[model samples]
Target chain A: MTEVVAREIIYCDICSFPPEYCEFGGTFKRCKDWLQANHLQLFEKLYSDDALAKATSTLSIEKEQQISRDLEKKQAKEEAKMERELQKKLASKIIIKRIERNRRKHVISISGLEVCNIDMKKLAKTFASKFATGASVTKNAEKKEEILVQGDVSDEAKEYIENLLQEKGLDEVKVEQIDDKKKKPKPTAP
Target chain B: MFKKFTKEDIHSRSNIKSSVQRGLKSKFLEQFPKLEPAIDNVIPKKSQVILIKCEDKISLYYVENEVVLFQHFDDLVPSLRTVHKYPDCFPKVQVDRGAIKFVMSGANVMCPGLTSAGAKLPEESLPKDSVVTIYAEGKENALAIGKLTMSTDDIKSINKGIGIELLHYLGDGLWKLVE
Candidate 1:
């Protein structure tokens, strides 16, 4: 059986050598030096900065300025869009409320703090120690994990969270006060 | 169980000598005779093997772009983990849904968990102390790798006690090495 071998041909203008064998001759540097010594005119024409500038002179100054302005506008628009998205994300309000469990018993429920870049367990511990009450990280009825602090500490917790956010440089965090007591309306007299 | 490795350490460790690599390949093959064909596929020729010794007597084997295998003091041979990239490169034992959490949390594989209703085992029984990969039921990849405490035949005969001693599992230090 006869074997057929297929070979690929690659040519470099400066080196005038096959691409595979070009490395053996120490890249195009050797070829450039040879060209500089033997073919001065051609070397000067090919390697000169003036030739490069002339080759790229097709675009007028006005066209170049317009292209740059367009690119800058596009980049500015992208940056603005990214900033808006970041604001939207950070604007997710951390909702704090006081939930009445029974007569004279209340618990402060803090939600949406999970979205913030803070440890939930450590935050719970801090709340527990700061308020001298039992605080725990538990999932609400909606299966959303939130921090629950014993007693009506919404106002205190809200201030603390805001300060914590500010200290962490998360000034964009918005705290929303939600009163769970007002959620259920009293039945009208019939 | 792990020490921080610098960029220089990684470079020096990865450039293992050819003779040493060959010895490692042979040792690995001898330990798992079933992986003879797939050995070259997993650790290909000219592939660099990096052995990083950690604080807890565990050796991390970084093969090319992936963390392929790990060895512990109690382990007679190196075992493959999920981070190895190539699934089914080694022998596998699928555990039940209830056992997935424990396995991922680095708990020893109990016989009851493996013999549960939904669990699956290989038709060909593996010998005791053999390196085996543990896969979760309904999952496509291996979750942990361990050494079988008892032979597959004995495991089928009995229903209690630890069946596999976990060496490496998901979220273990070795799993986080590549990251």
Candidate 2:
């Protein structure tokens, strides 16, 4: 019978392989099969075989800390990107400036009732031209009025309307500057 | 323990219903000693009464005869911020500094009356009912009746009539209803 003998083993540095088989760390670390074949390379490089038995135990805690920090940085970057996009979208909605001195003037109420009292058809026509939306008067005797305007109203348009009312000597003209988001436009069917 | 009271067992059932009824009556009396007579008169004879207990609050309402419960649930007034604008629709409410007070048949109701009514719904909008809760206004108790309107916002800004529809006269003390 031949004598049988067992020798000590060595493992790869990066991917955890036996050192005798792995001359360089790069090949084993980059190769998918290399790590699986030489599972103890990285573990052996960091620790002895006795320590390798507890390989996953201490390693996970350090890895978990690293992963949490990386995820936090990624989330912060995404939130900043989203905020920038929202600002851009909101900026595009508004078209604001001082009122033009010579823009043609027309007297129309924000509620659209004052126009109805003067002329229903004429009021509708004027509203269609300027607002390009619609108006409604309550059927009941209370006859509350509401107006819908197309696009976004600029500060200039608002000022013009206020000036027209002031010139007409109306009292306490309270004009609310509606946020573009709150101002809902009518849906076009086609 | 939960007990089943089918139609047949209604009369033969335990005195749970009567016990609840008595408990509610006693609680109501303790809260509003003054409104005992008004409550006794207003509550229908066959009205179903229940006492609901919540965190630091208790409430009693006569369900069967009170149609106002349906209106209160419909108005969504419990979501309202204020009731100042609809003086005609709502009972004549008194404003003190920032708080609002209203009286109905010698009961007090309170509201902050902060919001305006109108443009509340998206389209084909109609006014909704309100759920006003009465609290003490200075020395007076508020009878929190539901307001019949879409929003207090419209009632305030429009200078209109009938902002809130009076639904119920909830007493000031002991009884605070929670949906």
Among these predictions, the greatest lDDT belongs to 1
Give the poorly placed runs of model 1, Cα more than 4 Å off: A1-190, B1-14, B73-84
Each model's TM-score, in the order given?
Answer: 0.44, 0.19
iRMSD per prediction, in order: 24.2, 42.2
lDDT of 1 by residue, A1-190 (tens): 2222222332334434322222222234555666667667756765688754553354456754564455456446655776786787687888998888776789988988855666687999999999999999998999877999999888899899999888977788899887676445578899
How far does residue B9 in candidate 1 sit from its true spot (Å)?
13
Off by over 4 Å in 2: A1-190, B1-102, B106-127, B134-141, B170-179
Q: How much lDDT does each candidate structure score?
A: 0.66, 0.35
**lDDT minimum window of 10 residues, candidate 1 chain A:** A18-27
DockQ of all predictions against the true structure, Cα-based: 0.01, 0.01
Model 1 scores a C-alpha lDDT of 0.66
Error of 1 at A93 (Å): 26
lDDT of 2 by residue, A96-145 (tens): 22222233422223453352124334544565566555433223234643
